[model samples]
Target chain A: MAFVVGMLIKTAAVPIVVAVVVTWLLHRLERLKPHAATLGVACGFIAGWFFQEFSVWFPVRYLDWFPAAALILALLPRVSPITAAWLLVPAFPKMVPPRLWAVGLLTVSTYGLAWFLNKATDKIQQRVIVGVFMATGTACSLVLLQSFSLKFAQIAGLLTASLTAALLSANKPYGNAKGLPFLFIGLMCNLMFIGYANTSSDVPTWCFALPLVAPLVLLWNPGSKKLQAVRYALVVTILMVAVIPALLVHPPWEAEH
Target chain B: MSRNILIICAMALLLTGCNSEEATNPSPDAGDNTTPETSSGSGFAVTSENTKVLFVGTKKSGDSQAGGFKEVSGTIGVDGDKITSVNVVIQVDSLFSDQDKLTGHLKNEDFFSVKEFPELTFASSKVEGSGEVTITGELNMHGQTGEISFPATVSVTDGNVKLDAKFKVDRTKFGMNYTGQPDNPINAEVDIEILVNAE
Candidate 1:
């Protein structure tokens, strides 16, 4: 029991609890039914603030991406793509000097990918996109825990991914509308990882790109509908293959020793 | 819909405002210094060249690592051999650990967050004793301030005053609670030694 409690604290149970409560509340609001992505963003922002105000270990700037990404998703459906893309402009100045060019490249690439994913035709494509988002979020969380010894970031990532998954699951028959939230989260998570990589030592360059690229394996499209589950497993397996080794190379528990 | 977005934007701005001021560009000289006339009369400038503030923290394996500030400046007020007041400012950015990686990590958010809080300061509220010294003061660090007391040995020779002290401080008291790992954790209590020279 003592070890379990220790693990819970290490995993940042407090913030996760707050996030779950907030997400549940937002889900219950009848008025918010059409704006679930916006609700997720708001909840993410609150969770981030809760973490910071309480002096939890997650970097506040990185946590801020949750709301920022949600806002982008919320606006994508309401305005022109060009207008919605402007939402990320405020964060550019905070990037490290050497990372500015990379940020620009990432922004353009993510924007293009999000735009393309927004037009995904079938349920299988949408599911793949969602799976990709889930994998990236989990991978980044693990990376934070293993590479930088950032337990708070790891917990925050887990909470955000779980909340996103719950939200997506509850609102099934997703169709084309599902891509927006997944794309937003995927892009933001990737950006956060990149920003972290720029400042951190011992993080390999491949760790930065693997999550974003791993989802592309799903683009090959299995020939039959019956094989969709196998394809999903394959994509996740590839992502794990890419991410787990990186974590093994630099375990957070062994870092200080 | 627009109203909700506007509210969120406003909240974001408010949250941004709560961030601490950047620690990179600390004021070159921001602490109280006794004026030349004051020093000539009843006080002495604490010379940075001869003063040292060192700290030893225990790692998970119970081994100790010592680090210290390369720069510190302060003043000591005295009236006829009776110490009156003390003021000290330590540059957090000047902290150096045994290893370069540890030094960088200490400066980052995990330990000092020097980018957000660049200076640690102490100002004495009361000073007592003669041969031995007891200083009750406020120590400010990591955007938090708290009172602390430590005993010291004081000596005056050749028109110069010197103080030596050793004490333990809880890092969590100053909001630095980055204790790592459950099985092998960084010790919360850090041993600190202070040496001050004033002439």
Candidate 2:
């Protein structure tokens, strides 16, 4: 009974969290309905899973060509809306992670961020710079996990900092490998953050504020006191209960095992 | 670089040769009385349109395990309605499962020890029973050879031969001990269900 209750709670929480994120993003886009936003998020998840399952019995597990295919098909202006909706399910499976989902997510996210930043600054050089930072960060994190904190810091600092400094001094080479380190670092950071989030029993209210407040401050700078109060109260309420790093605990038995 | 390439090529050739028949009749001793009659209709021939082999069994540690050889090429022959030969060529690297971690581990040293012993072949010394057959054979796995007896149902349906067999073998008998307790055996009783179709 307790196990059932726990499972039900988890199932409910995933959609709720996804919905919350979607709602927040859509709030900035005028005339976008909440239902449409929810649907989009759901579709993306389904598409991820579909592509992920395709790896099974499909010899090449690493080459996930579905995401790019979906993006291209989506861009076809003459494509029917219903066709797009049907394509969304297979696309949804692609978003779900297989065993190495965390690694892939970090790598892709790093590369994506670098590309975005490159576009924004009109400087291809930033790609290498970002890549160096990410790789160094991952290596440092891994080393830290291996040893005492002080030793980790000393070794990581000496090795990673020097490597990054050298790469930067080279004025950012236009190599494909530049983005790799950043992806590694990003993955480590995400894993560590999840670990910390789950382990800390008493999460300060400021924790919730970081994800929500940082973007709002950067983009909107709202002056309404009422909205500010609500945000603070919400954060406080969230902080009151421990934010157990949800990713830390996996089921004792593997579903397929 | 050339050395590495040469080594890899040699290994690939070695794996290829392993799939080929080693001997029509190979005995440990030069002077042996056992003569396996090949021409006397003494082999169980399995036929299938799709020649894929699948295995579902519990690991020695009682973990529900399933994997299959993507490239399993074999011929099972019967002598007088009994199985006398089982030549199975299971690609060690081709063993697959939905579970990625388990699949990788199975290919590692703890389980299949695929690098060391890439193929499993069971050649029977004796065959008994009628419709329900009991085959006493030498089951070679992980380079450690052991004698095993198991029951099988052999039949011909619609011009195609089907072989279904189930047997339990102690992995320990072949030096595959990974985990378990002395007081309460954690080492699993490995159950094998093999269905083969001759091409």
Candidate 3:
């Protein structure tokens, strides 16, 4: 009973309330309006703080603090959001041999995805489409990450909530990532870390990469709002069908608590 | 100087690989079949049947949950009927609770987080007195090591030894500060009971 209540508060109530409030506040300032999408990172920071200890010394154990650090990197006016990608450095999972090349590839890929997502969302309407897509990706992340780490999953939950509320209230708050050109890059960083942390899941590797194809939806420039919604549903449905369904079939005992 | 730094970074890159299947199998620290040693290596190995380690956690509303670790391996160092040292290693993944879901939740970050830090260890830093003994040691849990002192009873025979103790630990001190809800909060004080028999 206590566990259920704690999870509800940590993963549900606090995340939705914090994300919505932050989105509403950011929307109030004209200057900060453009950066409203960074709310996903902000909520992720909150969830991470609540879920994991900031005082620990181990490398991967320090991940709960990464969201806050990444948020700082993204929100700092003097720095590039791409700098948040450096989180991949501290995020090196000790359970494996250090893969420097893999880290480099992931960092570069995140930057590329950020750039591509930005270009895809240049228009206001396109921003909403990508925004919804980012939310969907976050929802997928919450599910997949739960199979291994709840801290990351809760972080994913906050991002999903923040994106959803931001999408509704601000029209297009999933506008940009922490300090970068795209929000999905931050989500990708989270998904990548979860993948590294995942050692017990039966879910295949490629399924983890399914949501990175958000830009593929941008390829079809829909002529009307109705068609765009259709495409959005089609894309998210396919991604959900591809990932969440198979993973849900697992009995609860198999999941890492 | 910059070139040397780059070389070092390159070297670091070569040394580390991506995470794999190591976490699936939880184990003690590599090469840590730690048997508490003395002049004669009097550390007696006890079977699970003869040993018991248990904990009871409560809610602010007064509800309680009890659990124990399934796999426990440790040694009680004895030097000629005098207890010298105590070492214990608990596999976090082996945690079991009265409720199955709570077992999983306890293993998650809200409690044990067995995925990252897989073992809880303790090594005696100070052992004082005899009979009714005060055992002071570093109790390492959830990656935070804290010096904890508890009282226990120690008895020794020719080839058999028995030790028993009960104590309280603040979960918050070990970094487990999950307050359940506004109405039903988790109590910080957790009751720990240990019984060790070696023959």
Candidate 4:
């Protein structure tokens, strides 16, 4: 029992529980409201920040703050743009002048890209875009965690994967059409920060590109009888392809001969 | 749609900018100018063949595991029975644990980050005491330096010196802060036993 409990904590059981509860809440909330996806994303962002503050898995630092701030801006652009912009103030003190400017620009641009992707005419396209973002973020975070031997990477990956699964399920034809791109943007930013911060060795350049490239597979729209199944299969295949190389290349455990 | 694809491609290209091997792997430095050059025919020379540096770390269960380095080289300046100075460098890559997996893990980024911090060095700032000697020095490891003091018994005979010391060092002080799991936590204080033979 002691060993089991230890393993559970090590595998990030807290984040898993949080993800399950958030997914259930999103499913229920979507039934009652039109902008339920936005609310759900906001909830997730808050949960991530809360966990970072209280849990050992997430570092309570500027890197974690930027993602939550970006999410707020994306989700509630009209209501919280100024407040969210203010949230980025914490990042300035931690970085040098040049780095602060570069990261600041990147954060704003990425948030813009997520906002643009959210405006897709086709529902499937929007879901696919969000899926790709989450999948890539998960893969990158996993690789970073594995490479650096960080326990928190597991929590980050679990949270992102859970959110992706929830988003994909919630956006089915009969389900709520509203998807959570803002949440994914925040998660991706967090994972990207982890990847950048944890990398101590020469990881293959292709590992970084795989997540971005995997979604291209979705462009092949097969008009089959089982169209939904094919799309799901394609998404899964893309994610697997993106993640496998990262696990294989310069694996953290491989000892130097 | 075409614009979206282009934007995503641009985003991917921008993310490529986030690739940072330099940030994680700090530039190696022989920190604080503590590594002193050994002059021939002056200071007593210490080599791998004549030195043994063993470290004992405890698990959360209070069980201790011992590990040692196969290679260490140093120089100790002596004036008669009084030790003047000492400079020792232990190869991080040369660590030998009872468990091979543990050895590999120790060399990884979680502990020594051997690729970045390949060597651990101790350069004595002051050496005092008559019979049982106390050496105060700056220990550099894992890109961090801290002052440390240890007591050792020194025995010199026929131009050969053998020094033995057992000391406790907090691994967290050197940035080695992985403390295992809650039920299986590793003790922060590592017991180190040093045996140096200089000729």
> Which candidate achieves the best TM-score against the true structure?
3
Q: Give the per-residue lDDT digits (tens) of candidate 1, residues B59-90.
A: 77888788999888877777666676778888
Runs of candidate 2 with Cα error greater than 4 angstroms are A1-257, B1-37, B42-53, B57-63, B79-84, B157-159, B180-186
**Compared with the true structure, what per-residue lDDT tens digits does model 4 show for residues B95-149?**
8888655665576656776655677888899889855899999998876889999
Candidate 1: clashing pairs of residues? none
Candidate rank order under lDDT:
3, 4, 1, 2
Clashes of 1: 0
Cα lDDT tens digits, model 3, B46-139, are 5466788899998887888899887777788887777878888777678888765567567765677666667888788767888788999988
Per-model TM-score versus the true fold: 0.62, 0.35, 0.73, 0.62
- CAPRI category for model 2: incorrect
Of candidate 4 chain A, the 10-residue stretch with the lowest lDDT total is A88-97
Model 3 stretches with alpha carbons more than 4 Å out: A1-61, A72-102, A123-127, A148-150, A164-181, A195-209, A212-215, A224-230, A246-257, B1-28, B39-41, B46-50, B98-100
What is candidate 2's lDDT per residue for B1-199, written digit by digit as tens?
3563355345445544554322222223211223345655544343224455566655345556676767554456655444556555455557787765556546543466453455655667665766577878787765568899888777644444556787777877765654322233334456676776553
True contacts kept of each: 0.00, 0.05, 0.06, 0.05
Model 3 Cα lDDT, one tens digit per residue, A130-219: 465555556465455434444445555555544454455544423433243344455455455545444344555555555666545665
